[model samples]
Target chain A: MIRTEQAEVVYPNGTRALAATSLTFAPGAFTVLLGPSGAGKSTLLRSLNGLVRLTAGKVVAEEADDLREPHALRRHRRRTGMVFQQHQLIGRATVLANVLTGRLGYHSGLRTLLPFSATEKRRALDAVARVGLIEYALRRCDQLSGGQQQRVGIARALVQEPALILADEPVASLDPATAERVLSLLHGICKADGIAAVVSLHQLEFARRFADRIVGLAKGAVVFDGSPSKLGRAETLRIYGAEPADNDEDSEEPLQLKTGTHA
Target chain B: MLAPSAGHIGILHEHRRAVLRHAGLVGVIVLVCFGALWLTGFFDAQRLIEGGPALGQLASEMVPPDFSRWRAWVGPLVDTLAMSIAGTALAIVISLPLALLAAPNTSPNFAVSQSCRLILSALRSVPELIMGIVFVAAVGFGALPGVLALALHSTGMVGKFYAEAIEHVDPRPLEAARAAGASRFQVITHAVLPQVLPQLADITIYRWEYHFRASTVLGIVGAGGIGFELIAALRVIRYDQVSAILITILLCVVVVDSLGAWLRKQLK
Candidate 1:
């Protein structure tokens, strides 16, 4: 239900990070944005919440105002949630308190300072439970594992009860097994909640294995868009510009170089 | 091991020469500064050696402090504690907003941040005693001047610490709040404040301690505290009363410091 229409983003230093690209995201779909680093993946995700502005174009949602207006933009962002690569939880605060922060935009400043209502507290706890961290609700974020901390990040987003969730490389710092687990959990949550998600990742195998639709970016342009089954060796070669170092289909080595050098 | 290469030896020799030169320079600078102090009679050890009897006589007079004048000393002791408490409370109130404005990441604009920093630096450049004298001149002698003096200087000290703490907050949490549709103030309250609260409390408590010590001496400039009473006793040659005042101030500081430490531990 959300789409970018000929969106372009140029940095202040004149780097055209995103060329004019038009793409529509379907509701309840787990879409993976696969690209090398600096391929405008983060920039594109950030724009969904108005964190990054489009230099020329419009980001719109059906039955809502154009997202370019400042007033409407903030309202749009309130309905959209984002997960950062870093866990981004306040390490000094309890996990439950961190999740409660997701409701800050909905409440008045005076209200936030006093205390949460019983219903709000229950919903925050529910979000924590949904992320499988209800046992750690009172624990500080610093004590949690990297994977757990990322789950707290997901919980924070979930508490917002957002319509659209944009995750930018959410599992880059985890081990291969943990990465698989978190991605599967994220995909399952999106389906169960009937919320659409656009997850950007550098790993192609996970994208192929988890995504209902795949949108590949190379050189800041969408090079491939199709079902996950269509993303085979030929598609990988086109996106990566070469056969991977060991494209044996089973090696756990990362598909794209971490530095994301173009072949 | 084989002999090292000539290039390596040459580099090592160069390093040794540099170290020797730096040592010689530091030694010469110390000698010059020490000679200057000696000629100015800043501290003459030979005079101290010769004045043992006078020093011993002075030390002997301070013991068994006469409590006969204790009734009069109580008012000023209480005044000193009150002055520091009020001043520190005032400083905390003023410094919190100024610190947020001065922090690079939290400031609304570059000009506003620079202005806040410059204003705080100007306040810090003046010593509390000089500030005490100025306030006393304006307000006419009382605890109010002492409180104002301590509050201004403490605001400078605590505000800088607050700005640094705010600047060091993790950017990711801030970004998350922004993406969650938080306004500027909401982001600061929800994300930035939680991370920096403990360190900010520590800095504020430390400034309170410093203000307590400063308030005790601020009365020497006629701003009204234990220092004023001690100076009066000194003029009347009542050394016993001066010792009583010193001991009272010491007890109060120790008790306050202990309470502060306990509270900080609880916060941790």
Candidate 2:
């Protein structure tokens, strides 16, 4: 479980990126943060993994105040897998190699010098299979499409077997179709592995369709927190500065994505 | 009424960028003044006239090439190559640790990194020829002293390159490794090593080839190499032997250059 209590972030120049906002995500829950640009959505996601230090208040993950010390926070970060909006995959490395980086916490010393152990290699391969990129494991990550690269990012996170996954605007750069597919895979993986997921989204439609629960933030504070069905036009207007389309307006039902298959 | 009330804007914005440009011009003016002060009274026509006559006299002594002691020069050329290879090898071994310690981002303490850089700067401050003379006195006149001198000089050079290489590496991988709970050593081995290894190889080989040429010159001070033979040939007025030695040195330099090129390509 990940929780933030009145957590606030102030930049060095006194820009308050996140205000006194508090949020909690249940275990195995797929929660989406819906907001517009500069709404502190990314800041909130970074706070969960202790990537962004809180100027005041506490960030608790797995029942510990994560923003305690620099070194201690780093250890907590290992348990939480983070996906950047850019995918942040090391493009030069092979897909398998990039995925195996997720297991860095498990090895030390000359163990890392030698080739990764067979069991660890198997686990990494299993993650590639789970992401349905087993065929491209040997290929370089730079060759993959934007959607495929995001999947590789998911594969990297899956390899960690993390307790919680924080994806900051995971699909903001992807196309609509590709965005839906990537979100579906992320949702399926989180559900299967029982990992709490906090995915930030700029698109209200994708968040509404996929997120198990939706949280709205405006000016670094949570304005609404409830089920997707309960997210009304008033909250959307407040979060987005414009009324969003009704959730039931779309004809398609909720998507059921396969583990390794594209929806 | 608003259309008829347009205010005249002054030339205030015209000189906004002029301030920085004038600052740069002032900096150049200061440098020129210092350069003029430093170079004042350094040139003399009479000294050059005297030096020119001496150079002509020296040139007149060399009438023809005499290749009599080709065998004698060959041994020393081999010695030069051996000295360079050994010195570069030793230099690489010593500099790797010093470079890692000197990298500000990698080292834990600022003082340690600063001290490491200071030590390298001190080593580099002394000329290689002076170092050779000092080593020869201590070790009693052998190729070992020459190699040690070159190694010490090359250590400073390699350490500088290593520090630069460390600086140029992408910080993202290191950040990720730190986030992954990797120990300092693990982060270095996984994140730092892979990124810089190929570049390290390229620079190391290039330095080795460079030192190969420098080792020949170090032999002039009895540090041991073809330079000793060249000096002897000049003293004996054996221009042929000098020519032979010079040709061999040229060939060796060409070979070293090609080898450097090959190694660089291989690394890529």
Candidate 3:
């Protein structure tokens, strides 16, 4: 479980990116934070891991009760895994090598220095298999498609084995179909692994399909947080300030069979 | 369709301008080269011709090359080679930390990186010969001074190149390492070092070759090496002995160059 109490983030330039935003994340659920650009979605996600330090209030995440000391923040960050907007895959390294980096926090300084042992290699391979990219494990990151690269990013996070996964616009760069597939993958992985996942998405349909709960943010404030069935057109207009022009007109819309399995 | 205007040039107009610019640049280069040759007296062909026979006769007198004193000369030659090796080795050791400190991203603070860059620039501004003279005065005439001069000179060159190599490293791996909770040291070892190692090896070998060349001349300041022998040969008008030393130096340079190339290939 992760919770932030009146967590506020102010940049060095005095820009208040987040203003007293507070929320609690339930475990083993796929939570989607829906918002427009500059709505504090990314900032809120970064705050969960203490990457963006909060100028006021406390961040209570699993295994990280405090954020005052830099050392403690780093130690707490180990339990929080984050994916970025750009996928942020190391383009020059092999896919397998990139995934192994996720295990860096678990190893000692000397072990990190030495080459990966057989057991470490096996674990990395297993993570690769989990992402369904075992065949491309040895391929360079640049060779993979955007969807495949995002999968590798997920694999990297999975290797962290974090209690909570924070994905900041993870599929924003993929095509509509690919985005659907990736989000479905994320939903399935979170459910199976029993890990809490907070995925930020701009597209409402995709969020509505996979999210157990959708948290809407407008102007750096959480306007709505509830089940997907409860998120109606009025609430979305409050979040986006306009009715989506083509909800029924997506040429490649994902086949929404059933909403996320949750009671 | 838009007409070519003062603010914008057409393809043909730009092509003509480019030709004019290149022509002007070449003209300036030729003029500078001629001016330099004239100032240095290198263009005085008549003066060179007048000394040809005297130079030939002087060269002939030092024949047999005075190899009978091999015992004396061999030790100084060894000393020169050792000076090169030791100086390059020391420079390599110092350059590693200096490179990390000089790198803007890898370095912890901007002030530290900037200060290290400034210090390297200061060291590089003084030539090895000047460094040799300064060291000789402080430490007395010996290979110790030569080693110090070579080491200091190479440190400047190596550190600058090494920092550049560090700067060009891909930031993605570093980000991944950081996100994975790797400490600064681990990030440097896993991401930065591997990316920069090949280029670093190339730079080190090139520096070694350059230091070897510099070491041969360090003896001119009484810093012990074959340069002392070369100076003695020149002072005594034993041009043949000088010629012999020059040939040996040429051979040694070629050997080192080839060896360095081979080692670089192996590293690659």
Candidate 4:
């Protein structure tokens, strides 16, 4: 489990993205960081992975080296996976090649220059199949649709086999149905593999319906940290602001958290 | 950031005045440049008119491009091609690493990047003809000197283009690789190499075509290529032979240009 001990991050431009926040993430659980845009959700998530260093306090992980040291930080990152909002797939490469990048962290530079080992190749293919992109494996990534590209991004993260996965708005650009499918696939894969997943989402309904534990963030502080069942209407309005009606969102959307292992 | 309002007559008039002032400044600069040129006696209308009959006479003599000297022209043409190939190949090898060093993002430090830029500028300052003369003095006249000159000078131009291209690569893939704990070298190989290799190939082929044309002229400095033949023919006033040499160089350049274009298309 990773925990931030009163962690704080203040950008050089005097923007306090995360202000003296304390949070914990457990293994094999789907924890969604819920907030509207500019809610410091990304900064909080990045701080956990050492991508954004806290200007004060400290972030620590149990059974792992201190992230304060550079070498230890890299080692810790090797065990962690990240999926970007833009998918960040290498556009010129084949789908399989982008997935093989997941193994880049595990190989030496000279070894990587040579062809990937048969074992790694097989793993890459398996990852592609896991995301149902087997047919597109040999195709260049730019040829894929936005939804397919995000699926490839998931395949890339899956190939890493990291103990924890951090997704920064993985489905932000995707349409509602595609977003649901991608998020469900991601949540299913993480749960099945017993890997912890921390996904940042702006959609209240999706976060409420999908995440096992939802961490609400607003104005750079943890506003709520509890099970999805406990998040009341007042808390929702408070987190997203009072204009939920004017924002054209359903005021009372059902929060049916997925139960029974998705077979 | 405020937009100028139409109601502000003073501001509108000032804008027009600023434009008129700039135009006046440009006119004065043009006048000064023309005055300097006149004072130096650089413009020679008489010499231009006087050369018309002589040019016509030379053109009349060059009517039959003497293909009888074709046997003699082949060796130097081949030598020019060889020089271009060798020079371009070596330049690519040398500049590839330097381009990586010169790029702002990939460079080890700002000092290294600036130093590489400085080196490229210094190398590019001297024209390839001047470089050929220098090399011919150092290494003696031959295709080797021509190759050395072309390679050294083209490195600067090609390296700069490469640095610019590499610097413009999207930052997303780089961040993904780095976040995966990829070392700097690993990130370069995995992220940077794939994106820039095609562009690098395209730039190198274009430079090769340019060097091919430059290599022909390099022999004028006694570096040994077709230019030596052309210059020799010109000195003796053999317009027919000069015409043949010029035609051969033109044909070679056109062929190389097509080949370069085709190869670049393939890379794309």
> TM-scores, in order shown?
0.92, 0.81, 0.81, 0.90
Top candidate when judged by DockQ against the true structure: 1
Better of 2 and 3 by DockQ: 3
Error of 1 at A176 (Å): 1.7
- C-alpha displacement of A136 in model 3, angstroms? 4.4
TM-score: model 1 vs. ground truth: 0.92
Question: The CA-based lDDT of model 2 is what?
Answer: 0.79
Query: Candidate 2's residue-wise lDDT over A1-263, tens digit each?
Result: 77889898887876677888878789988899976566688888877766677899888776355668755565677777777678876666788887888788767567877888889889999999998999999998889999998888888777777888888888877887888888899988888888988999877777878788999876677888999999877877777666544432222212221111111
lDDT per residue, candidate 3, A1-263, as tens digits? 88999998777776667789779999998899987676778888888876677899889866667766766666766666777768877676789988887877776667776887788789889989988999999998989999999999988888888788899989888887888888788778889989899999877888888899999986667888999999998998787666655333232312221111111
Q: Which digits, one per residue and each the tens of the lDDT, describe model 1 over residues B29-56?
A: 9999999998998688788787998878
- How well is each residue in B1-268 modelled by candidate 2, as lDDT tens digits? 4443223223344465678789999999999987886687335667778899888876565545556667777788889989989999999998988988899778778998999998888877887899998998899776898999999988888888898898778776676665566667777777787778887888799888988888887888789998888877778877666777787799999998898899899877
Which residue pairs of candidate 1 clash? none
Ranking by DockQ: 1, 4, 3, 2
DockQ of 3: 0.43
lDDT of each: 0.85, 0.79, 0.83, 0.85
Residue pairs in candidate 2 whose N, alpha carbon or C atoms collide under 3 angstroms: B65-B240, B66-B240, B66-B241
RMSD of 4: 6.2
DockQ (C-alpha) of model 4?
0.53
Predicted complexes: DockQ each: 0.70, 0.34, 0.43, 0.53
Worst 10 residues of 3 chain B by lDDT: B62-71
